[model samples]
Target: MSQSKSGCKNAQAEFSRFAKPLVDEALAHAAQGEPSPDDFHKLRVALRRLRTLIWAWRPLLGRKFADLERAYLKRPAAAAGEARDWDIAISLLGDEQTKPDTERLQTARRDARARASSTLAAADLKHALREMLRRVNRELNTSPRRTPIKCLARERVRAARRALRKRMRRAQRANRGDYAPWHEVRKGAKRLRYLLEFFQPVLRRRESRRVKSLRRLQDRFGALNDAVATEHLLGQHREVFADAATADAALAALKRERKRRRRAARELLG
Candidate 1:
């Protein structure tokens, strides 16, 4: 078949190959009655990767549909992240005077897990995921006019790279007390990393080599995020602690860690 007649690179087959395992992973973990903290994290990763994949194809796929698909994937990941965030808080609270807070975190984690499981297991999300894939296949198969596949991939990956660089600069210029800009840089780094990996086949050697640096950036940014998030989470529920002093101590430790991590992450931003 001519290029215009069948413009996509067997996108239906590629789409299934990339998306099915993630769907299966999500459903499998969702089915577990008592999914572990790791399970919730894995589910979040799968959902996040699926969202990134959709965004990577946006250059070829219509942006409106791609945006809608990404939004659809966001809910399950957010649900799963609630559980995962509690897990992060639990780990952050050291074995000092955190016994009380740890117990509360565990309770919150259990609740979040149940909610995540229910959200994932519900027929609506599953149906939506299936329907999204079907629509992707239909669009790819029937769209007569389309961008060249490799060109499309290159444009998306390069655009992600440019966006990441811009974010890093903005984050670097942010005040030491303002964490929001830094947090945005973290997200941008992740998005670029995922896009590069997804379109590696069409990437230049130097572009692919940048993954190592991106991984290091992620490590630093992730450490800072964990500490800051733990602090924020604990601060929000401080009143729940039976002893006010215990909450103070936990927050104190988290602040120290957050400062240290913030410094480390800032070094990377520069």
Candidate 2:
């Protein structure tokens, strides 16, 4: 679908419209007892998109309000993040060898889920999100300066692309097996992907190829990162393990997977 030609005002309104329902949906899902992984994932994704929009329009919103909104979102996002990490760990490393770590993760996951539910249920959260949208609308209406959203989108996309390229270059130049460098590249890739998706309506047809390439890179990086995260989690909670050997085995398997994923990512980059 084509974006409205009107410009930033229309874009702000469109973003507000898209964001409200996602917040409502997230709140509703959180209200349910033991929200599913899918529900948490959806909530995380919704908030991410909202944050991305704010970031893309930082100049329009002004830094103070943008920082305020982002800070307000951090708690809920972290809650969801904690739950998500456990969810991913359990899903990927649930074999007998990882049973000890899995159990610990499950305990942590339950705590995270409870925190997420409580945070979502807070009346202040809904009120703040509503107020944020209202403030953004008000700011957009009152601001004297105006620019076409397409122009802004193009500028942001180019900037994101440049950032991704720089990160990729750094990753390529550094030790290929270094998880830290690759993880940084993954984050850049994710940001670029989000930007592209947000601006797809204004992008040209040929951009689809770029989108696909970014997606593939993101997937590869995500796989490697997930393994690294799981291994880290297991290592951090070693004292909680019922069977240290089991945890060790799981960590070994994760390291092997990380290597494989790193190889795949390198090949894709080339």
Candidate 3:
């Protein structure tokens, strides 16, 4: 058809080629009855990358298919996320100081892993994803949009960076102890980083410095997010601890860590 349509189709084909192997690998990893924590992590990351690409191309794909694809991807990603959170918690807490808490986290990890495995094994999920991809390709082929693939990629990257910068500024202006703003900033940084990664091939040399900065920003915010999640998880299961005093001490330490991380992130923003 037209030049823009051709560009869009080419871009879609490129993304599908890049994503298919990753999806297959994730599915294979999840098919195992007892996949390693790394397996789930890899699957979740693969899904995230795919979702980011879809989001960047949402305008061409339309709202209906984009929403459907997002929903399909979200289920397994969330399941994997639960398992991953527990894995991180278990690793960070260690076995020495909180034996009872450690045991409880281990049990939670097992349950999350089982849930993730079950979700991944569902045949409907695979069918839905396959159908969605088919629909996406069809739409890209027929759509009247004339925007070049590189133009679309650049627009998305710019938007992601602007959103992240705005959020970071708000977070920096907020009180240091305000966890909500920092968490929002963390989400923004994550979205921006993923978008940058998806557009890396299209905008390679120009994005090198931006990619490095985004990574550092994401890491700082991710550390803060993990600390906050740990504190909340420990609070939720406070009764499981052998000594309430120990639980309190652990939570206090997490809070201190969170504060330290928040400060570090803010310093970066400034």
Candidate 4:
């Protein structure tokens, strides 16, 4: 084999080694008729990690193709996210769990879980995941553009870091009440963290050193997301409550939690 072909095969082999377990884990959970919280979480996480891997390879795969694949995966991602959000919101209710509101949320959670399970079971979704993997590996092995994997990894990881720094600046300048920029910051940070983790073997020692800080950043940002996302999810059901007063009380609780979590997230940035 030519040098490029040999290198490409090596890249394909290493990536498959890393990706196959995640695929199996996701597929195993998807096959379950009724998935537990942990199973659902695993399914969601696996899908996201796969998307991150796609992002890493987009340089070789072409951005448009990568974007399309990610978009196609979003339906299952959304369903799983909603289910997880319901669980988080319910957990946030804490001592209020005995109240009727908690029961209402639990009922919603059941529906969300069923939807996620249904999405996971969809023929198209299953085919899509498998096809994505097959196609990606095939391209890695056959594509004429034989970019060295190490060079690609370094370039993309550095670009990810730059993108994250830009997002952080935007978040810092954002108004206290406006979380959109901050949300972008959180996503950017997550993408960078994934890139670093996945490409660490090929990246410089300095790049690997950022993992600890990235973990801390992801934790703070994720806490903020939990609060904001829970509030957003619960807000949609404002009219579901039989009594307006109870609905107001439930929502008020979420607002307080959002406020508290946002503070911690903001403090971390400063």
**lDDT over C-alpha atoms for residue 220 of model 3:** 89
Candidate 4: the clashing residue pairs are none
Better of 1 and 2 by lDDT: 1
- Which structure among the candidates has the greatest lDDT? 1
lDDT of every model, 2 decimals: 0.77, 0.74, 0.73, 0.75
Tell me which residue pairs clash in candidate 2.
none
Better of 3 and 4 by TM-score: 4
| Model 3: per-residue Cα lDDT over 1-270, one tens digit each | 454453454455555765676567666666666879888888787777778767777887887788778777888888888788877766556546654465765677788788878877764556666665677777777776455666777788888888878887888788756778888887777777877666565665667567788778778888888888877877887865779887877777777777787778777887
lDDT of 2 by residue, 1-270 (tens): 445553433455556655677668655655566778787777777776777777777777888888778777766776777777777777777677556644665677787788777776773556777787888778877767666777777888888888888888888888755678888888788777888876777766566568788888989988888888877876787754677787688778778877888788888666
Tens digits of lDDT, candidate 4, 1-270: 443443344454556766777788778877777888888788888888888777877777779887887776666877778778777776765644223354665677788888877777774556677887888788777767556666777787888889888888888888888989878878888888888887766667788899888888888888888888877876787654546776677778778888888887777676
Question: Candidate 2 — which residues are off by over 4 angstroms?
Answer: 1-14, 101-105, 175-178
Runs in model 1 lying further than 4 Å from the true structure: 1-13, 99-102
How many clashes in each candidate?
0, 0, 0, 0
**Candidate 4, superposed: residue stretches over 4 Å from native:** 1-13, 97-102, 239-242
Q: After superposition, how far is residue 55 of candidate 1 from its true place, in Å?
A: 0.8
**Candidate 1 least-lDDT 10 residues:** 3-12
Q: How many backbone clashes does candidate 1 have?
A: 0
Task: Give the TM-score comparing model 1 with the true structure, all chains together.
Answer: 0.89
**Candidates ranked, most accurate by lDDT first:** 1, 4, 2, 3
How would the candidate models be sorted by TM-score, starting from the highest? 1, 4, 3, 2
Worst 10 residues of 2 by lDDT: 1-10
TM-score for each of the candidates? 0.89, 0.85, 0.86, 0.88
